[model samples]
Each structure stands twice: as structure tokens, then as C-alpha cells.
Target: MDIWKLGAIIWLFKSHVEGRAGIGKFLTSFVDNERKPTTVVFHGICWNNSVKLHVMKELSKAGIRSSQSMSKRTSLIDHTVLLLADLNCTGTDELIINASCIAQATQRELHRLPYRWLVLSDAPRSGRSSLWDPFLVDSELVLATVDGAGYTMTEVYKPSPTSPAILTPRGTFQHVLTDTRPHRELFRRRRDLMGVPLTITNTIQESNSSIYHLLQEDSLELEHDLISKNSYTLAKVAFLTLNATPVATFTNSFGYLQNGQWTGVIKELLEYNADIGTNVGMSQSRLKQVMFLDPLDNGRARFIFRQPALSVTANIFSLPFSPDVWIATGLSSFVAGVAYYLSTRLIKTRAEKGTVRDAYLLTMSALSQQGCEVQPRHVSARIVLWVVFTSMMALYAAYGANIVVLLQAPSTSVNSLATLAKSKLALGAADVNYNHFLFRASSDPVRNDIAKRVNSDKGPKAFYGLTEGVEKIRKGLFAFHSVVEPVYRQIDRTFQEKEKCDLMELDYIGYAAFHVPGSKKSPYLELLRVTFKRLREVGIKSAVNFRFEARRPSCKESIAMFSSVGITEMRPVLIFMAYGVALSVAVTAAELLVFHANRYRLRQRRVAVQLGRI
Candidate 1:
């Protein structure tokens, strides 16, 4: 009878060992097949070595790597960690104490929370225990615990950024000792918040320079800048798709990193005070602090200015006709000049005594439509003169017509960043938060030089107010670095239709658009991504973008609207006139010198002759 009892006890112990092993097997399968983590970290007290070792051994068997160190901090955003805790290690009846110990051990190492958790204990699952209270609000986690002969799992997630972690049962893994079926549905679709409340923050300074302002609940808009407006609207659409309530908060700035810390919207996200950030421009530095979703605006920040005058861009005298046409004109003039010279020599007329130089001068006078004292009376010479006159008259008429058109046409030379940097146009940027920072931070040589020029000219006040910048752009020769939509709106209101015809832009900040940002390892990130993708796929996003951002206003007025020519437009002509005057002065000086020399020589000759006669 004693042998029979001993055998029954051994059988019971074997069943318990198999049950524990089966739990380890299931966890190994989940980690290896489902999560497929590159590196898995294990955190457990010394007393929980058996449970951790069993799982680690199984993971190793499945060709997975595991780490035992818990002191080093790792980004939970990219890496997955599995934590196991023995709830009975402390000999405490209270579950909160055990949970607190687990939270404290990991809270320092993991800035956020672990990817998965397993709690082992002989105690029954209780309703009064606050096991998940120590973690950050809405941690979006999956945890499992021993439930009788089987195991039960629950997920902790937030419906919104401000909401507390909601614990929901994810069903149980029964028949652990014999079950071979894979259940991939446990963690899938867990991101669907099922109508939770989230908080989204934006930079809505109370000052007049704010990117956006509150018009109503969940309604934000910008008067001049539409980038923030469009993003805000898209974020709202995402929240609706998730059936989550969005709470809006406003701050003074988008956020700036100062003294190794962040300020404004970025600070709120880092501290987990907000779920998502609106109108956040993506940058390498910002990416380290938070995760950004799909780009809301792909529009680049650029230097917008009027196209410069053609004369300012190129020599107006040479631009009216092509090189070939100019060559033909020169050849024709030479032939006419030479013919007139030969005609005078072959058929000498009493009225016309044309030397080589005189014939060339006469040809130029005909081209210029000027009168000459000498006339060739011979019929052949006269016929040659008429042909030259008629051809030059037609060429001069075409040249004049082209010059008039070119005077009004815009210059296309300053269309790219390299050209813009080399151009004489004065550079400035809108006084928004990111311009100065991005400009100075750029590594490109051209951008660096542009930033330097702006700072050298304007110093600390290098940036201009939107209206002030737009006003300078309208005044001409000023390239204001700003997003297009806001500048377009300002241009639409103040600039004339004729002025719009010359409006041009050069790419400065090359971002496709500003993106909506969320906290690092945000649970709503995927939902935000899918929501945006859906909006784009269905063309809703395009509609919202079109409504807020303004395109370049069309040129309604005739481009030939007459205005008095400024020095900038007539620069080539002025330069030509200055050269002509300088040459004329030089020739007059040479002639005077020659006249003085001739007078001196003649006087000496006269003196010699008088002396000889005496």
C-alpha cells in the first residue's frame, strides 16, 4: 500500500513538470515565429531562473539569440524584450508588491516598457490586483500568467494618449501539454483602439505668428500657412477611422532643442503628455526623439521671388537676335561698305569722293538712318545703296520689335538653387521657427553660403515677417525663403496680376512635406499610417491638401503692361552708352594730340625756310 502511494505522487510530479515545459514551448514558438525578434532580452530575479532558463533553452533550440543583461538601456521602439517574473519570490500575498518589484527593476533600463511579459505563480488570478498600474499610461503591451492547468493572456493598451491602460482578455491557450496548433491571432489587430480618446498637440502660439489657431473644438486652421492646417485635418480623419476622440492642445512653438533638452510640442511628446504632434517637420534630430508618420505636406520650403528682368540676366543688345542672324547682318554691311568703296573708284562722280574709311562711315550712317553730305550720282552705286538701305531697315524693325518684347519678359536663369545662390537677388527667410536652424545646420556648400549671406546682411534679424517678406518680394530683387502656400496666399491678396506673371521659386528646404509626429514607440503609429494611406488611396487627402494650400496664382493681366523702364531693365543700354562716351573722349584726346604735333612740325618747317631765304 505504501509503494502504491509513492508511485501516485511521482506521477503527479511528472505531470506538473510537463505542464511547465509546455508553457515554455508555447512562449518559444510565439517569440520565434510571431515576433521574430533579432535579439531577445530576458529580465528575471535569481529565483525565477528555472522559468527563464527553460524559455531561453527553447529559444536557443529554435535558433534564436537571448540576452541575460538588464542593466543596459535599449530602445524599445525597435527591439523586442521578453520579461519573466516569479510572483511568489518575495513570499508576499499582495500581487502589487511583486508587480512593483518587476516595474522598478525594468523602469530604469527600459525607458518605456517591454514588448512581452510572463508572470508565474501558484496564486489564483485575482480581480483586486493592480498588476499593470506601474507602467506608463496606454503602454500597448501583451502579458501572460499561469491559469490553473492552462495559461491565460491579456493585453494592456490605451484607446487614447491620455487614457489609462485598458486590460482585455485575449482568450486562453488551453491543452498546453498536447496542443500543436499555431494561433497567430492573439496579438494581431490589437492596435484597433475601439473608440478611445487621444490627445494631439500643435503649435498654436497666442501671438500673431502662430502657425494655426483654434476656430472650434477639433478645428484648427491657418490664415496664411496651410501646411499645418492640412496635417491637422488629416490627423482628425485618422482619429475618426479609429473611432477615437481627439483632444487638442496648443503650444507656442513646434519645439526646439536647447541645452540638451526639448521645448514645446516635442517636450510634450517625449514626456508622453500627448499622443501625436501636428505640423512637425521631420529631421534627423527630431527622429531620434520621436517617431514621425506619413508626410502630410510634400511641399518644400523655397526662396520665392519675381523672375528678374532679361537685361539684368543677359546683355539685351545681343539677346534680340541669334548669333547667326548677327553674323549675317555684319557680313551684309561689310559687302555694302566694300561695294560702295569700289564703286567710287570704278565710276568716279564729281559729287562723291569716297575713301575706304568714308565708304564704311556712309554704310553705318545708312544703317543708322542718318543724313550724309556726299551722294553717289552713278546709277550702279545708287542701286547698291538702295539695296543696303532697304535690307537694314527691315532688320532694324525686327530687332526693335524683339527688344520691346524682351524688356517685358521674365528671366529664367535663376530657376535652380545653384543659380539662385550665385544670383544678385537679396536673400531672406520668413521668421518661422525652423528656417534659421535648418539653414545653419545644412552641410551643402551652396546652402551654407546662402545662410551666411543672409546672416551677414541682416544679422540676428535675418528672418522677416511673412507680410514684410512678401512685400519685399513684390518690391523685386528679393528672394524670401518660405513655404509656398502661405506666400502664395499673401501674393494673391497684395500682388498685381502683372506681377504674378514673373513670380518664381527656388527649392530651399527640400522636404516633400511636414509630417505628423508621435511619441517614440507610439501604439497609434500604425493606425496613423494606415489612416493616412487610406485617405491618400481614396483621394481624400488630395482634396484636403488642395483646399488649404494655394497654387501659384494665374497671370490674368497682359504681360505687356507698360511701365517706365528702370535702370535694372536698361542696364545693358546704359553700359553701352558709357563705353561709347569713354571711346569718344579717348578719340578726341588722340586727335588733339595729333593736331598739336602737326602744328609744331609746320612751325619748325616755316622757321627753317625763312632762315634759308635770309
Candidate 2:
């Protein structure tokens, strides 16, 4: 047998023998026998009932004995076991306090003789705040609470109350307070006895008494709303099979499913004004059901919802002029201006001999051969006219062309203002044009279209990218194009680029009285109307501001004039003047060199011819 068991048996024998033998004789017998010290188990008694008698019988059979006696000091038991009885006088809290004191004493004398302590309770209450302290103080002490008769014994121990609580070998303390409230006076006495800070938490019902009505009313209101909103089909079906009563029905019906569906159902019930008791039960059932349900597949759902769409007619209408066209037009104007200025100056200075006309004609022919048309009568006039005409035409053409070019530019081609504002489309990576499109297309019809597109995909699995509306575009993954410019500069730039896109001024149509009015002083509102007027004043003949070909009517008269200049004195005069200027220059250089050579050659030739030295 185990040493402890043997010790217990010896202790039982001694106790029984001592009861029959007197104390002095028992001591003398023990010394004469030279027996080792025996272990004893101690138990607290309450009314010494039949249950206690039965327990005593069981201990006696196990070679363990129990005793209780009033003494000045604590009793000496090699091994002490404290058993508690279910009695009304000594409440659960008081019983726990006394057990705590006994356990503390056992701990102090741990080194003296190996000893074991056991605490057994029948029908012990739970949820007492300080019930866990004794178990926490010692690990070797075994504590148990068993259900006896119609009552359950709930054991609990907490190492620290301020921190997260853990269950000890004993059950939870919170179970203790379910039936009875701890007496405040009893807690005070225990605090005095144990020299520890111990407190009992009052029931939640006792606190918040005044505004409880408001909470109830709110709960009722929420419940109604939830019932109206919840999918009632499932709940109704589940409620039918177990329809013994609403509570029993739901509990029995939903007890087997996964927690998620249960949680959802409980949540729905709560929203519909169900009582707290029902809500709690449903919630617990739902939680259990959820634990059994398959883990959610968020990754797969995201993949399915995030597929990209190809857009067909994005911002084709709002296309800007290409950048290359702007560069070409500007360069051509500058080059033409320089050429006309130099050619006309040369022709004018030599025109006094009437050869100027011929030179002018020749220049016109040369230009005509090169596919350019001359329109003025005089060479200088033609030069000035061509310069002014070309510059003006290039400026206007470039403006219109630039607008088109910007609209068609690679940066703008992937998406346009209307497309960006109207459709769910993404901009290119690192595109600066997105900002311009956003600002300019604010009133475009496409804005509504984009909004609708985004709304359709609204969910956890929605794909958000630049191809979608600019505002709804996702960040980090999606790229957007933006332009940085002074606020005023964007206005000018937009106007310059608008013509190429063939955009017309948008009229500010007043909506019905019920519709909100747009700002009358809006800069965008001004931009549309103001540009129309400006273009008209600048000789652009458009029925509406953006009517194509109206402002670009071919000038037949000018072409005819150029052709006439080629046939008139202009061409012949240009040839003669070229010859005369070449002759004059050649003669001048020849005359100077001939004069020097004549003087030297005449002297040498005369001497040679006369002397016949050769």
C-alpha cells in the first residue's frame, strides 16, 4: 500500500483504539509499540446528519478517519481533509472562508511530515467572489464539489481577480452566486480574518435601475425592425417542427446546426424585439452551430468578384489633340514666318529696276512648285501677307489641332473625360491626366453611368480599379493619371484642347422648379459660353461653337491670286533680277581683279611681244 494509505490506516487504528483505551494508556501503548506517527483527516461537521454519517462510513472503509473537536489551538492531523455539508446555517461564503483558513495553516507546516489535504463539499453553491482564493493559494490541496441530492456543487478558484481569470481544478466561482447573494457582513468579517481585499459583484439587475425602461423600449423597437428585415422563411420553417412552445421549439430545432446560422437567427430575433432570455439561448445555439460550419472562403469570393471588364466607348467624344500635332503646328508657323520675312526683304530692295516684279513672280513660281500659294501683288506685300496669313492660320489651326491632339494624345487615348467621369474605367499607371478629366467632366452625362456601374458591384467581392469611376477607383493596386497645373492654366488648356475634340458649349438649361439650380457664376458655366463668343470674334464662323468646316472654308480667291502672280510679271521679273544681281556682283569682282591684272599684264605682255623673248 502507498505510504500515505498505510499512514491513514495506522491513524484510524490509533483513533479507534484511543477511544476505547484512556488517553494516558493510549500514549503508553503507542510508545511501547514503537509505531511511526499516523496521518489523520479532519472534517467540519454541520448538524451531523445521515449524509455525514455515510461519508464517515466511507472514510472508515478507506482506512481514513475524521474527527472534530474544540481546541485552544489548531488540531494536529498528519493529513487533513475538510468536508463540508449542505446546511442552511453556515452559508457557502462562510464555509469557503473557514476552508481557506485551514488550507493556509496546512501550507505553513508543509515541511513537517508529508501530508495531504482534501476538501469535499456536497451541494456547494457557486458565484461567490472569494470562493476561489483557497484553491489558488495551494496547488497540493485537492478541492472538489459534487452534486448531491437535487443540488449541484460548483467549485471555483482564481489566482488573481484583477487579471484574466482561469479555472482551477475546482469549478468556477461565478456558479456560486446564481442562487444566493453573498451577505455583505459575512464578507467584512472574512476580510478582517484573512487580511485580504475581497469583494462581491452585485447582480447586473440591481445596477442601472432607473434607465432600464429606456433599454427595454429600445430593445423592443430594434426587435420589430429586425423581424421586418430578416429572412423569415428559414426561421419559420425551423420554428414549426418543434412547436411545443416558442422557446422549446427553437432550442430543440436549432440545437444541431452550425453556429453561424444560429447566430444569424438569434441576431434576427433580437432585432425583432425578442426577450433577452431568448436572445441569449439562441445566440449560444448559433455559436455552437457556427463552430461546426465550414470555414469561410473569402479568398475565393474575392477572386470571383474581382474580374475586370473591357470598356468599348470610353471617352472617344472628349478626345484631345495629339501632342505631336501641337509641336508640328507651332514649329511650322515659326519657320514660315522667318522664311517669308527674309525672302520679301530681298525682293523689295531690288524691285526699283522693274526686275523686282520678275523676281517676285519667280519667287511665287518657286513657292508654287513647292506647293505653296502666293496671293499679294507686290513681292514685299506678298511676303508680309504670307507671313501674317501663315502665322494666323497656324495659330488658329494649332489651337484646334492641339485640342484634337490632346484629346487623342496617348496619355488621353486610353480614357477620355467623359469616359472617366461616366464609366467604370481605370486610368493608365501614373497618369496625370486623370485629375484634369475629373475636374472637366464633372458635369458630363458619363458621371451618372460610372456611378451606376460602381453601385452594381458593391459588396465585399467588388473589383475597384481605374477603369471604374475615378472616385470609386481602388488605391495601391489601381493606377490613375493626373495632371498638375495652376487652376487657371487648366481652364486655358481645356479650351485649347476642346476644339480638337469638336466639343460645343454646353447650355445651362434651367431645370424644373423642383430641381436644384446649378451655380450661375460657375467658372465651367462661363467657360462654355465665353469660348463661343471669343471664337466668333476671332473669325471662326460656326453656327454653334463647335460646328466643323464652317470656320475652315477654303479661300479660292487667295489661291487664284497666287496662281495669277505666277503667270504675271512676277515670274519673269524674278529671273531677270536674279541674273542682273548675279551679273552686277560678278562684274564688280572682275573689274577690280582685271584692273590690277591689266596693269601688271600690259607691262609684261608689251615687253614680251616687243622683245620676242619667248
Q: Give me the candidate number with maximum lDDT.
A: 1
Cα lDDT tens digits for candidate 2, 1-614:
69999999989866644432222222122222223343333333344344445444544554544454312234454333333322333564455445434445443233121233334444443444454444432223334344431222232333323332233332222223122324312111111112222111111211133123222323222111121111121122222222211221121111223443332233333233221111112124344322111111000000001012111222322233456855765575455555554655555544333234443444444433333343445566566655555555555554556444333322322233343443334323212211222223225465434333333335322223323322322221122321111111222233332222211111111111111011221111122223223434554323221211112122233221211112222344466679989999998999999998999999998998989966
lDDT of 1 by residue, 1-614 (tens): 99999999999867755656666566664554444464455444343456567767877888777667534443553345565555655642243334333333434223233345555555445433455544333243445566766666665544443546566665565654322324444323443566676677866532444433433323333444355556666777777776777776766677889899998889999998887876767778888898887876555678899988887888877888999998988898999999988888886666767798878887998888887766778777788888988988988899899888887877899988889989989888887666756567458998878888776645654688888999999998899988787788889999988889888887777666677788864555656666778889998888877767778899888644966678877787788899999999999999999999999999999999999999
Task: Give the 10-residue window scoring lowest on summed lDDT in candidate 1.
Answer: 92-101
Best TM-score among the predictions, by candidate number: 1
Root-mean-square deviation per candidate: 5.2, 28.7
TM-score for all predictions?
A: 0.78, 0.20
As for model 2, its CA RMSD to the true structure in angstroms is 28.7
Q: What's each prediction's clash count?
A: 5, 60
Distance from true location, Cα of 270 in model 1, Å: 2.8
lDDT of 1 at 143: 52
